[model samples]
Target: MKVIIAVLSAVLLHCTQAMAAAQTGFFIDAPITGIQYVTSSGIEGQTDQGAYQFSDGDVVDFYLGEGPSAFHLASVSAEKWVSPNSMTVTHTRTINMTRLLLAMSDFNKSDNILTVNQAKISQPAVQDFLGELNLIELDTLAQRYDIEIPSVGEAAAHLQSSYQYIKQSLSSDEIVYAPRDTELRDILIKTRNYQGHLCFYNVDEIDNPSYVGPVGSTTYKITNKGIFEYPDNGDRYGSNDGVIASCDVDLRAKRTEEEFHEVSSFEGWSGLFACALKGCTRTNLSGYVVEEYDSGNSYKYRANAMTFNPSTQIVLNKKQGLGQHEKVDGPNNAEFIWFTFASRDVTPLSFEGQWQEKQINKEGVSYRCLDIKQGQVWATPFSDSHCRARNSAGFKNASVEFGDMWWLQSSAKDLYFYHLNIPVAWKDSNQTQHYTTWEYLPVSDSLNNGILYRYQQILDEKDQSLRTSQVSELTKL
Candidate 1:
């Protein structure tokens, strides 16, 4: 009897030891398999565009189980869209071992469903997508009068491919810490911000330049009025200063030494001339951006290459010192004429041929000319009418002794947008040594003439002030 009892004790002890040595693996109920446990907010019917995919906006559970278990369980949580602007846990806290073990056990679950209670998932996740109607919009303005609007692919293709173009810009390092989530969150917010206008309109193609007969070969003009931030605030449609922008796009333009390949590169434009004022280099240009933004919206272009003009080199530092109110440029003392345009995507669904034509004074504007892809906007008269219209200011601010103006110089009018800008540094006519990619343009009233007529404000509380005010106003008359 004594031997049997001793044997039973030894067997029980051995079983206990075996269990202790083995790493505890768990089976998660469907939802927690991926970081975005809830793919839809209850309001979604199926991709209503109002639906929510809580990948970035969701607060998810983080377990440090990539390697050996520390036996010490830590509870880390974060809000993807919050200010300190990171998904990392601000502080660490301890939780009951029982709850953590349950969460950790589900880590290895094959089922990818969010059956778990929404409350249990995390804190500050998106509860509803349509709940806040801060939707994105695309607008187009024909830059050239006789622009040969190119044939375009489907919206699904551009949108899908755009997703890839932006994804490629995010380096592996930006997401190494939390590999699964927050990788593309930066661009997502940027896209949200740029599209957050208060009131926008559907551009109508006009036959005649409202002011005169024929201005130039390129007669297309951009008329934008009141770009709103949210649907709710769009009610006050009459409050925005509209603009009429005319330009002629040259398809042959090329960009050089410009590395906006990443969204974060845009963020580096933190302070005033951080690069130009201090002198920038290819090596340090990457450091100039403070954060990566959704520059993709600016890239809704017709041409594959995003450039101001041929051979233009975007100086990383010239875009510095811009504030939320940077659009308000005082009387030009500066000749560099650094300007950025708030463009709405105007690409057409299909093209009959290169030259887009419409009856004069059409009710709606159709984007039929050179499709604007992305980047800051600069104007060089494409036609005699356009040239004369803008010439009201004076003679050429400067001369373009060099650049890819061969076609324009040789073309009929013997002219092209003389000023170079976008994808890099641009200069006004006064610049003699502007090609160094460090020169600033002369600050003229006309420099920002195109971007002068717009105001955007937010109406939704959720989208109003995540980390900063969701309001933006720009007047460059």
Candidate 2:
């Protein structure tokens, strides 16, 4: 009986020795699997503009097994749980992979103790992905634009693949630590290729305790398929400003540098011409011609571009002007006619295809031309009978000046008139009579010579004779 008891004691001692050895293999305080814990208030579906928020001071649970035992929101301290944002835990508590196991082995629940067979845990995939993500800088602009970045709660979501990868590449010498910034979470997420480059917007780093929000914003692409372009505001609209600015990405690249291929670019005045006359019957017609816009008051400004020309079938002279055999000027101020028409010898101006016309008024016409797009003006002429009327039937080129606005006349002269001032108002030009884009040009003062009946040589969509107005305003005189 004594021999049997001795044998049992030896066996028990051997088991005890084995257990101690196993315990020694694991670091007493090795980091547990879970370091992230969402606050109690972070139940689900709480967001501002589809963004989730995280608060500090939440008690996180680190478990021994990756399968059933991992870190989670086991509980929270009463003092720390009062307010979600109030959970400010001291940074003094540092938990890592090496020390987590040693710190919790004495717990009654074995599952609560973090453990691994080896002293070091390796995960290359997680590390590789995290490493790649670390190179990416997270800015407020990136967040607003929806670029992927890391967050505190994202590691567990990708634990299986990420953990195994990091484990394979991990070594005792080098350890992967928890990212201080949550943006690393975004880098781990696999996403589609982005086509647009980044353009930094604003920066406001002073608003938060971490001084993070002030990093500003940058515009970048979400997809890499080389799809449509993204405007400055990140949205496409139908306004003149939107359409005019939405030039082809490739075309912009060719004109600018190769780097701008990924940035937004526009042709400016050329783009406006395209928007105004694209799909017209005379799309083939090209050459610099005169285009005018009204100033906020009573003046007008005209610009000359090579793309401006009459796209109509009407017989016109080589030069576009009042009477036959007269020289017409380019849209620029250098070519603008400043005649007040106070004398009978008012010169007849020649137009494309041998057409000719001239102003007949003798009361001294006066007007000024402004270039709103360029924010400048032509020779500010203040004279009498300054308005000029086109004898042609083309309505698109005709313009009528009202109290304080200029309306764009369409081919049909019956569509919604576009407001020149605000650019977005496609409503009726005259409040008394609701007009369409192609409706009759409304006149304000008949004696005041508010409307200048002129016609552009632009053609219609069906290859029909189309004439549109460039601009109209009150007689500057």
Candidate 3:
């Protein structure tokens, strides 16, 4: 029994040692090659195709050239994919290292890999030139290469531009940079080939019969560049649909927390009574929000509530030639708007042909409609003349101008008529004029043989009021 136990202990020790052995990784920001890397674990070599091998907990320092003349560029913990930005601790240092890397790289190569020009970078003259450059000089160099580095408080914008520049320069569809010990790196390694259809549902509509809401379906694809949604048309108001950012994976919850920005406009009026009202207020609002989503299960994502100040202009009496206006600042105000989405495997369905309004609320309805070949909806049923005639009793000469219609397919294989900033004006019976815009997403229902239109919420221009629900249906005509 002692002999057997000794043999088993030996085997276990061997296995543990093997697990601690060096693992392969890459240096990117275009897969830089021919750079020497030395790890604290004693592993040292010039990167081949940007590849290196190091064990966990190892700190790596990168250099150029050889012998006493070799120049140290940056030092970072061993990672699967290391870039200049990841190696540096401060933004200024990151920019400096990035500029040096760009200056030393051979961009004319056809393979899209950045091969460090050893001959040029090793020269004392070239080193001096790069070392003497200050922030303004670096900015000039970046501009010459058409690369944009955003100002302070614009990290998101800078990252976006970096991603775009890398994508364009490489002409490659997949581009990713994973720093050490990051969830993004783990996610990329685990789901490198993941691609499918994702259906989005509003958080409040998950318990509803059809999971219907403002959000719809989109194709989610994973590339080295991170997850992107195909045909991402910014479905939700003031929110972008493509290229989710700052994603942190939660394996236990099977979801990822992502950051996004929501932009909107604020408007207000100041007056005690109708006779005293003669002022206008408008302000633009933008802020970041974080939301969570599970790739394989139903999850909810919400935009953070935000606050903003409104700019106001007042005119006391227009008829008295008191057209003089004074600008005033209003107190800070806040707003919160959020929705959730559910996803499923994409089922193929073509929405290329024409679909006509068939029924609304179980009542037969007909409308002349044509789906333009260029993916536009041209329907004449809701013209200005029709609107004026229908609401003539309450609003005289009322006009409704329909905005461009963009068709969006949902995960349920139905369609949503997405419209934006549709201007509407009407004069009430008392001749008081009103003007505003409307944004709405009206969804469709699938019958055994026909499509049915259901009730949809319409948001007014200010996003403060709800317009009356408009129900309509359409079928292939």
Best candidate per TM-score, number?
A: 3
Model 3 CA deviation exceeding 4 Å by range: 1-20, 127-477
Q: Score residue 217 of candidate 1 by CA lDDT.
A: 14
Error of 3 at 381 (Å): 88
* Ranking, TM-score, top scorer first: 3, 1, 2
lDDT of 1 by residue, 6-84 (tens): 9999999987865453321111211133222121112111111111123221122232222111121211111211110
Q: lDDT scores for all predictions?
A: 0.21, 0.22, 0.37
Candidate 2 displacement at residue 61 in angstroms: 82
The alpha-carbon deviation from the true structure for residue 75 of candidate 2, after best TM-score superposition, in angstroms, is 79
TM-score of 2: 0.14
Better of 2 and 3 by TM-score: 3
C-alpha displacement of 171 in model 1, angstroms? 5.0
Worst 10 residues of 2 by lDDT: 184-193
**What CA root-mean-square deviation does each model show from the true structure?**
25.5, 34.4, 29.5
Candidate 2 clash figure, as a count? 103
Candidate 1 lDDT score at position 203: 14
Clashes of each: 58, 103, 8
- Candidate 2 lDDT by residue in tens digits, 1-477: 999999999999987865443210111121233233333334222112112222332222222323222321112221211111111111001111112223222222333333242222124322222222111112222243343333312221222222232233222332112111111100010010021111110112112232211011112221122212223221221134432222111121211211223223333423222322222222222222223334554233322211111111111111111111113222211111010101121222111121112122212223433221111122323344232433323322212332122211111111121111011112223443211111111111111111223222232434322232232222222
